[model samples]
Target: MNQFKKYPNFLIGFDRFFYRKEHKSTRRRILSIIVLILIALLVIYGILVATNVNRYAFLSLFTRGLRDQKQQQDFITNIGIFTLAGLSFGFAMQVKIFNIGISGQMLAGASFAFIITHYLAKTGFAPAVGGQLITIILSMFVAAFVSVLTGLFKIYLKINEVVSAILLNW
Candidate 1:
């Protein structure tokens, strides 16, 4: 056999990596298809499980247990509140508004909600469950409204939102 014919000049370095036995490429292709099918099946299964109402019953029971536990209830509430605050802060930042007083705003909203709920309780105007719901709704609205006001002030007054928010908190 001529040397040139046996070893092609075009095959060199990393380019030669693609040169493999015929069966290797076929095996790889089959394996890739199998993996993709498995992944698709898993995603389908997850969607089926999530959409089924039976799964929600389990989740409800789990949530009820957490609600019955004072520590767990407080932990979850705190996490939710902080997560909302963080999201609001991020939104403010994206709009070129500084949100330096999220913590203070959250505290003030909670305090105001507590005061209102206390007054309602004393006046006998609010049922226990309804009062709790109103308190939560009012607190969330107050927090969101206060944050939006801070953003508006920053836009209208040409002042640093961070400074304005901090002052509002004080």
Candidate 2:
């Protein structure tokens, strides 16, 4: 078998990777799909790098994000927030209810929290971890309130949740 060395059309290599065996098992098919996707990503990255040298800085940004403690903390916080939001969305999905206002709710929650925190800080409250904890709690409460209001719209006003969510989001 000749080593596939085509530089321009990597799809040929992908084809060989997928169609190597006569009988493709489920595992082999999945493996081929994964490998093809990886190769495609590599080709796209190569194009980006070739088009602009500054594009390579994405690698450094990724590495720095991994290495930096503050960045890691921020990432973890983001993951936690998204995980909570995902769970809420999943619960809504399980009930066959679509809530498209998740991001808007979060924004409202954050804005409410900022306002409360600023007020407390102005009133000589310690702007420390305790303040942060209060802010988080208040933010979550505001988010829940916003979600409940959306639900109420769907329930009493006879508005479709998706339409209401979109309008509220706007």
Give the winner by TM-score. 2
The clash numbers for all candidates, in the given order, read 0, 0
C-alpha lDDT values of all predictions: 0.75, 0.82
Candidate 2 structure quality by residue, lDDT tens digits, 1-170 = 44555453686665666877666788988988798888887887888788886875757755666677898998789889899789989998999888889988998898998798778779987678886897888888988888888899989999988888888877
Residue 76 of model 1 has an lDDT of: 88
Error in Å for residue 113 of model 2: 1.4
What would the C-alpha RMSD of candidate 2 be, to one decimal place? 7.9
Clash pairs (backbone) in predicted model 2: none
| Stretches > 4 Å off in candidate 2 | 1-64, 127-135
